[model samples]
Target: MSKLDALPHGPEFRFVDELVSLEPGKQALGRYLVKGDEAFLVGHFPGNPLMPGVILIEAIAQLGGVVAQSDPEIAALKNLLLTGVRGAKILGAAVPGELLEIEATVEGRLGGMIQVSGRVSTAGRELATAKIMLSGEE
Candidate 1:
């Protein structure tokens, strides 16, 4: 199974399209394609649809969750959730037809909480970056 299988999101909510590389607990790289048919795009900007910053953040967090759950050294936690986000910056925007490259790395861990740093980029241009915290039942 793909490392992304560790994530609990359904098809509609899951953002990462493919896991390009993974280092179990250490890090992961993934990709997503903006298809323009997403429900949120309908009202995101009628004529000029753009992916929301919040969704971008969610994508990062999802990848983070995948990284956290794949750690062989730690017991997998149940029901992993994105509990916090810090220093989130949206430097650019993504539109339909753009492919997003996402990268996340495990920064540290405390009990059932995992801290991750992540970024979203496409065509060598970074669109967003953030440090996110994920918690799961111990």
Candidate 2:
């Protein structure tokens, strides 16, 4: 099983569709498969479908958080939790049945928290970007 599959999240909560690449302290690439039957799509504007912004951010957080926790410094802390997100920009929309590639880069670290930036794209078009923050846990 992949490292992501071993995590606590499962099913719909597992936003990462694929683990494309990982370069410590540099970047991490992941993929997500948007499903037509996704729970949010049902009431998300009905006929007009768009992936929810929160879900988009969550995917970024998951991808970035994985990178942060992998660091020996942060990993030594035992647990980690996503504390917040900032500067989230949804440049385009990702529709159901689309495959998304997410890239997260480490920006810096502060105390028990780590900062990262990420972008999600497909077909050479940008879907969303965000500055993600995560905190070391007990």
lDDT of each: 0.94, 0.80
Those runs of model 1 whose alpha carbons end farther than 4 Å from true positions after fitting are none
RMSD of each predicted structure: 0.7, 1.9
Clashing pairs in 2: none
TM-score of 2: 0.88
Residue-wise C-alpha lDDT for candidate 1, range 7-73, written one tens digit per residue: 7888889899999999999999999999999999999999999999999999999999888888888
Quote each prediction's TM-score: 0.97, 0.88
Candidate 2 lDDT over residue span 1-138, tens digit each: 665754456686878978888875557999998878888888886998888878888888888877766665444334566788898988888898899999888888877778889998988999889998877754
| lDDT comparing candidate 1 with the true structure | 0.94
